[model samples]
Target chain A: MIRFLSILFILVSNTIFSILEIEILKGSDNLSKVAFVPFGNESGIEENYGSQISKNIEKNMLLFGEFENLAVNEMLSYPSSENDFYYRDWKVLGVDYSVIGKVNSVNALGNLNISYSLFNINRRIKILEGEIVGSEDNIEDISKIISNRIYEQITGLRGIFDTKLAYVINSDADTYQMCISDIDGKNEQILFTSKAPIMSPDWSPDRKKIAYVSFENGLAEIFIQDLQSGERDSIQALGMTNSAPVWSPDGKSLALVVSFSGNPDIFLYSIRNKRLVRLTNHYGIDTEPSWSPDSKKIIFTSDRSGSPQLYEISTKSKRKKRLTRDGNYNARGRYFPDGKSIFFVHGNNGNFQIAIKKLSSRYIETLTSTSLDESPTISPNGNIIIYATKDGSNGYLGGITLDGKARFSLPVKNGSVREPAWSPLLN
Target chain B: MNKVLTSLNTFFLILLFLSLIFSMFSFPKLNIDETQSIKVNFYELIQQNDILFDPPAANTLIKKEAKKTSAINEKTNADETSIISKFKINKLDIKNEITKIKLSKEREDILRVSAIIQQRISSIWIKPNSLSESLIAKVLINLAPSGEILNFSLIEPSSNTSFNESILTAMNKMTFFEEVLSLERKLFEKNFRNFNLVFKSSGEIE
Candidate 1:
């Protein structure tokens, strides 16, 4: 009888336990605050490299306005090692996470060893710890590596602090220079200078070379320039005019616009055998072709629907599907990093702005309110988009985070900048 | 000896049957009675707009009136059929008014406490946005009667590792719901002692 009573009691308890469950779907509007503490310097180092490295990382993490920072004066205590760290020090300041490190001298030959650790204040656990060994000359590079690791650990997304950007700079009306630089506008290098217009600079998959359209021969022709050797080679596709060259993900082909005689169409040119295959045959103009992340389909703009609209074509099945319908001008569609959505220049009421649309949905959401935005390029992590916009007749690069929480502009160049292209992440 | 063993087995079976019948009837009595439910319907049908906002003395007056009516019904003892029926109806009306206040008060407490728990979790959970995949996970939380969180387990994990990790990190940051202390002992044990929190991702770009 006692055993039978226990079985009945278990059944009765199970029913009561299953009755209540609460679902949480919304998140807080507040951003996570991170505290970057200045590292303790070794006795022999004279450069103050400890604070310099921490300052650089702080700037990089706050570049996209992704997180808030703690003021140095507000810190109750500055601890440089795991033994001295305390969760109560940051918890009282409402900090979500804290980063601390120490600088050590490896030897008398000026080599430095830096050890860092990241902690979650609320959970009271050490999340990450690492050490980097580099010379004083590579302090900037070492800072970038540490920033990437901390950012990835916090957000679970790939770190893109090392990616580069390629664009065109027209110092004068006639002199056009194609330039590449670090994403933060550092290490600016001019790849080529021409007396004609330069457009559509795209980095190859391996990032060793860049393919761009140059009119140096008094005609729109595509050229691939090697960064290390400074060598230039043309695609040499038989066409009267060619422009807008975008590399395929495999680095074996280029999706470009070619007008054989008069009509502009989309074609895939193989780089190995120099073979050109026609992908689109239409009386209407087709241009600005970009490969999907999966390389299975190519998204382009065409006038077949009476106005410029976005359409995608399957490379395998050759089937076509229209992506935008509400506005007449939806041009230069490029897929997000995941290939599940696309962003393009949306024109409504004569205002050209950056907008995104999921391939599975019909509605479009605009990200920017600028009137003359174009040539939007997404970061490798798909968290931000930078596009070219007009600032009182001088074209400059404007950027906005996909979350719509930040708006920023790149450093102004000596001339008008146009056609910003974001490079892929380094392996 | 075999006959005696068979008889003993039959006796045990009969005892088990009686226990099952007892457990089935006890649950509803502990939860809600039919009289209380009927009173709740009457209260909602008439006084739902006002809720429990009436003066406290009104409830006491109703109790006195109900007792007076019952006293009259007993004194009449079938001598006045119409009078007795009228008193019985008045008594029932008074009983319903009281239960209406009781049930709605308990329900209001439940709703208020549930909202606080949801808001607390949402504030602390640093949601990492993949912005590409739609996913959901469920976490079962166990809390002590003093409103301290005893344990939590991820019963249903999402396909994205980051999403699951964020949820677990958020749960670890919390040590107590403490708001449960304001709830009645029975309510806390029934609803919050062991409950599941369903976390969902909306796939918004933000």
Candidate 2:
């Protein structure tokens, strides 16, 4: 009996410890790792847009959430052609792909002879290359197309750099401004500014209107602003705390945190009826409601379980189930665009980082190590996450793909930036 | 007595270690008779562009019209066929050019293009399982070198308005020959552009 017990224990432990093979979409999740060397400026032009071109391409790649970018700071050598390409050096650095280009002018038209070739770092061979010409104004555009072409050659996804993001920039405590910016956080234009505190600006499913909580009335109110007309209207809500306005997948309703019955809850307001239907009812603060892609269920932060954790409630059944177990604080979770899992902030050891939990298995994985990481928003493709981080005293936005690589920070000019909601890809 | 217990414990540990080694080294029998098989289409492995254009019904119509005109010309002699035949061909070519021009010019109108473009691309996607209430298929399509749809596939699944099967069905029936703009076929082939089709079934016809 003793021998049998010993053997049984060993078998059980071994079976339990077997490595789980994660079935990932092999080519589907790959982004070409391209390095745009500071484009060699052979021509003494008054301005060199070659570097700008590379940066633009990088921004486009990042926006598409398709390609993993090799940090220029980490590149071993500047290689733009097959001869200069030391694939061994790049492979040693764990890079999977590389891009090199040179920019020069032939005449006054500001002709740029940009020769770039992509290479597979692992196989150590050039994948694709071509020379293109562009004026100074069109260099960035030309570079974007080249980056996209290279992206398609490797990962086969459309480049998203050409896409834009709609967000609300809080100019001051009273002045809440709705704005749209390039994915790199440039070319920001205020669509509409409100004297009230704007909270939770969400992109319309079509990327046109911004639904947000505006406080122009001294009380929290939800407003939807059309990007074109700068026109605004109050979204239908009967209760207080009508914040956390999220557009449903249909764009016909708004899933929001409302508290008309004296307790904050998640409610759905129909755009047609302008009527209210409560989805969650609890005395605890039930806020930060996000709609699943199906609009049949919602994932929101609720304190009904004695602590703030993520909960999923069906819109039809109203059946509630707790989704987080490991963390004492898990709030502000957003469903992946695929709706298979949720990415949220998990507080462990008094530090908050992004954690993902599958809906079916409840398996939890922590993806961020930085403290004070909040508002975890997945890209439109559901392949990466962008969230706010406090790099020391200043809050900056950083992003990491689903596999936990290609970590980079968005440059902030003035004060800290927070609450980045990845907009739907603008056609 | 204590020594005896210690010896027994050592023997147990040794047995445990041996068992672990045996299990690690052994290969379990995966009997053909006992194992069942199910087909799994690994969509994730294929990196196809997600360009979701409606079917090429319009292009088909254009081709049909061209064939019909060519047939009529075959039956008629050069003398019977006045310059009208020549003008008709030119008219058709000009119309094709205009369609291309309209598609590119209309690209700037995001809302209009999205609505109309979706209407033209009408393939329906059925949910594979019952547990799924509905699936939203966002298809991204790449244009072929010939200005026709090269390929298109769905994006994320959303049960909301994004998943309406009726819209997809309607789109599948459309030929966006009307949407194409006049661009050099070479230029079209060299660049990548995406237009989305939002398929939702309100069950109410628009």
Candidate 3:
């Protein structure tokens, strides 16, 4: 019995130590090569602050799939400042860009200051240099800020590294939890836990609140909760099914699906006046409403034409038009950042996959070749997409670029993760 | 002119009569028997009939005309030889022109060089995520005689820094191109020394 118990304990510990890992199934050949040297640090510091920062930056950069980072061992020299940098050394290593930094204690009260610089090895010029001063506990946040700066300066697009992700994890058959984590699935915190199933978690544009569906009252109801204070507010559904709440781009209103009229229809809920207006009165199901970037239109899925298809309705004029026509089943469509195209789930035969269609044309590009892929959410940069897919019997989150050149999977251990909603870039 | 013509006719007739008398005398030296008398009677009858012959002056004119015709033919032969030589020279000139055209048409080397550059750049280029399919960046490159990249610059920037940087990186990766060394110095300098390359995500260079 002792031997059996020890073996069981080892197995359990091993499983617990194995966290969700990102698997790069495909990579683009045109990625820029970058190197991150271990930051210089003084002794007697409790933590390896510089190393942590570099690692965090590396992880965040890799999530975009457009950068190939060099490992620490591959670096020929560690230069924390311009005086130590030799462009020829990095050039000989075939590195296009290099990043170096130094960490030092600012005061006796445990405050720290980090100075970093990004260099373009080919041009032999320093592209960016800055410093961040904060407490030790905020090291991760500071590193992400550095990453955002570098990404913006290099790519000419705002970085989503400082953004967050809200998802639902089904712990068991009857237990579900709404969780929030960093964009790379780190520093996760459970926002709300319930014995009943939770579905369709959405983030407010302000990033301070999250609106999601909870079944704690024995029926589906929408609740908006403050992320910091943990306070909740529910819309009055009046004994009807309410779900799939998406915040408007301006954060003044929400488009939700309610079944009070004996059928699921889209309704606009004004947060200021507490007024509810029904946008669609079709007898078929209308759900998954996504707001346009301009907040002038709402794209939602409706089955009024005998199959699930996407439709766009103006918020003011209440005009409606069908958007998708090729497939028999199309749903969960969201506008890209540019608002010129949309990402949606398309069904073909028995397989459902993620696809993108241009708003002004009939061209539709199916992004994922995997079956049963759904709920695609585009990154704020409009370059990458995160969606939920199934592998064998487990559900995992997958990401792919708009061009289908890079692909990766993030598989959660011990449970199934779904309904991934990528928050907007937080100010 | 009429008197001259008559005198020339009489001279030809006198010559013909003399030749006939000579031919009859030269026929036999009186060796004929009774049969020879019959032969002589036949000849006397022919002479009595007075068969007319061409005058010597007319024969002389015919001989002079034949000599003049032969001289004209010889002159024409010389002219024909000169014309044939001229034709041969023209044929040689045409052959030279054809060879010049053939040399100009054998310019597959330029295409081969472009293909080499395209293949090398595509293998090293990593397209930036922020770039769209429609975006194109025009880059200018300067090369030395030894296929070394002397300088690289972007003529028209795409305003997307990452995309431009990627193009630059690709160019830098191809530091030396050995294929350019095989080209003639003049051809290389005229065409490949300094040129513009249009970069697109489709891996096509314009």
lDDT of 3 by residue, A276-378 (tens): 8999888888999999999999999999999999999998899999999987999999998878788899999989999888787786778898999988888
At residue A275, give the lDDT of candidate 2: 84
Candidates 2 and 3 compared: the better one by DockQ is 3
Candidate 2 residue B167 Cα shift, in angstroms, is 40
lDDT (Cα, tens digit) per residue for candidate 2, span B71-116: 6545443422333333343445456557767766644443343443
User: Quick one: ranking by DockQ, best first?
Assistant: 1, 3, 2
lDDT of 2 by residue, A1-427 (tens): 9999999999998755532111111111233355666666665756766678777777666663445677888888876456766767776675656777766455666566677777655445576778888776676668767876775555433445555665555545556666678676777877777776666778888988888777788778888888788888987577765889898998998888787766888888888889888888788989999999988889989888899998889999999988888868999989877687788999988899998776765467788878899877776756667888887876778888655535777767355566777788655
lDDT of 1 by residue, A1-427 (tens): 9999999998988875465778888776667899999988878777788898898888888877778999988999989899999899998898988999888875576678999999988778899999999888888788889999998988888888889999999999999999999888999999999999999999998889999999999999999999899899988998899899999999999999999878899999999999999899999999999999999999999999899999999987889998999788999899998999999999999999999998998999999988999999999998889999998899999998776767889999999999999999999
Interface RMSD, one decimal, each candidate: 1.7, 19.0, 14.0
CAPRI-style grade of the A/B interface in model 2: incorrect
DockQ of each: 0.44, 0.01, 0.08
Best by lDDT: 1
* Chain B TM-score for the candidates in order: 0.60, 0.28, 0.54
User: What tier of docking accuracy does candidate 3 attain?
Assistant: incorrect
